[model samples]
Target: MITFQVKDMSCGHCVSVITQAVMAADPQAQVQIDLATHRVSIEPAAADAAALREAIAEAGYTPVPV
Candidate 1:
């Protein structure tokens, strides 16, 4: 599992975009987001931590590894 702290994620749309970005990177990945804490946890089926991080970053957000 990999976790990232996305401070800019504030609403449902943010969650949706992040989830989509993660899924796009690894379709079989499992994603969990805590909007209140600004945390995103992912269980990647094939993608690596670096790839996932880039995916989130490409989605227009700052993903700080936590």
Candidate 2:
């Protein structure tokens, strides 16, 4: 698994959007988000982290100063 810091993530809605974005790039992606700590853990490490990042950006979850 790979862990990403999405410091802006703070609620269930944020989870949903991030999940969708990751899945769009790789349908079988397994995503786990921790709102309390602002961390996102994705499984299947071989997946393209860059694509996932882009998809999240497209979903408007831009990270700032994380």
Number of the top candidate by lDDT?
A: 1
Residue 13 in candidate 2 has what lDDT? Answer: 94
Best by TM-score: 1
lDDT of each: 0.99, 0.76
Give TM-scores for every candidate, taking all chains together and pairing residue i with residue i.
0.99, 0.81
Clashing pairs in 2: none
Give the range of the ten consecutive residues with the poorest summed lDDT in model 2: 57-66
Q: For candidate 1, write residues 1-66 as lDDT tens digits.
A: 899999999999999999999999999999999999999999999999999999999999999999
- Candidate 2, residues 1-66, lDDT tens digits: the string is 667788778789999998988888778888888889888777744567677777777888864323
Model 1, residue pairs in steric clash: none
Q: After superposing candidate 2, which stretches have Cα over 4 Å from the reference?
A: 63-66
Q: Clashes in candidate 1: how many?
A: 0
Overall local distance difference test of candidate 1: 0.99
